[model samples]
Target: MVNGEFYRRYLNLPDPYGQQETSFTMLFEFREFEGKMYLKYQREEDTYNLFNKTTNAIILKQSFMKELFVNNVLPHQTHAPDATMNMNRSVEGQAKPYNEAFWKYYNAPVETARDSQILKALSEMESKP
Candidate 1:
């Protein structure tokens, strides 16, 4: 499992944006926190990584969710009526434009040197056009 556990439930979900029957394969691990279960870790296969490519490699998208608290409060949408996303969009679109302060406050793991370098390169490329 590539340095990870696979005893948990695994899912093969259809990629909404994909054509040619592409799908995303996900592996999830759950943990009990405060007497309730929550997603501890998830590993998702990138649907775009095709076997037809010259490179014999697969990209796995992994996410580690933490600092979860049961609010018991109902969530209401604040998105515009013309929104293209249903439930995928985060509240107020705060997911983008990475905020250092927000991540630090939430105790998110700090990015390593390799991560920073990759982000810097992507930012430079995006800024070009």
Candidate 2:
């Protein structure tokens, strides 16, 4: 939801390409006030300038996962308990902190669950075009 993390993660994942180096790189950027996220694909040098931006801006709370998966922008995963939780947390703004103040409220298991969820999601999505 924030900065199209799901989309970017799916694209950059090391697979399907058969160890082939990517011709382009991707990143996510959040625009909180707009309640939307941007998925940016930056290509190599001037040659890349010829391409147009395939920007996807969507509501922060919306699930762009299905659409992304269909468009090959996201990998499909049926067992992403962690990712599901993380996504829910992110939507609710109850996520474990990544900053210094995180430990004050979060426990190890919570973090582990979140990580596991993300990993499972990624693994399921490893199959790509």
Candidate 3:
């Protein structure tokens, strides 16, 4: 939840003074290999903040889930002569023509409801005379 007010109301708690809500998060995973630590990935989440609610029974209206398992280790290279670099890339912004091999091998996340809406809108726009 962006604003803590919703949760506070649900939990029957008073609002905190000057509490600014954040809609950003980052997750990281690391592994140790050859007595050295290497980061798997540091990713920023893309969020759609629209919520459709109902007052009845529980229903699976929307969901996003991902399960990952890494058994084989990747090539760990270092930019520095002595430093070890695990992974390198921009966390956000436009996709660049970099790491073609890695990007080719990478599988994108499953399309969400928001993604479907966007695609449909684009298709409709393109169909306009």
Candidate with maximal lDDT? 1
As a whole number from 0 to 100, the lDDT of residue 83 in candidate 2 is 45
- 62-116, model 2: which lDDT tens digit per residue? 1121111111233344554564444333332654457877667665555578899
lDDT of 1 by residue, 43-123 (tens): 555333322223434334343322323334223537555456443654345235878887776866789999999999999
| lDDT per residue as tens, model 3, 1-129 | 535542211112232212212234557788888887776555554322222233323222222333233456655644444333222433223244689788875887889999999999999999999
lDDT per model, in order? Answer: 0.49, 0.36, 0.48
Ten-residue region with minimum lDDT total, candidate 1: 15-24
RMSD of each: 15.3, 22.8, 15.5
Tell me the number of clashing residue pairs for each predicted model: 0, 2, 0
Q: Residue 36 deviation, candidate 1, in Å?
A: 1.9
Kindly provide the TM-score of model 2 when superposed on the true structure, using C-alpha atoms. Answer: 0.15
Q: List the residue pairs that clash in candidate 2.
A: 82-117, 83-117
Cα deviation in Å at residue 101, candidate 2? 42
Candidate achieving higher lDDT, 1 or 3: 1
Error of 1 at 99 (Å): 1.9
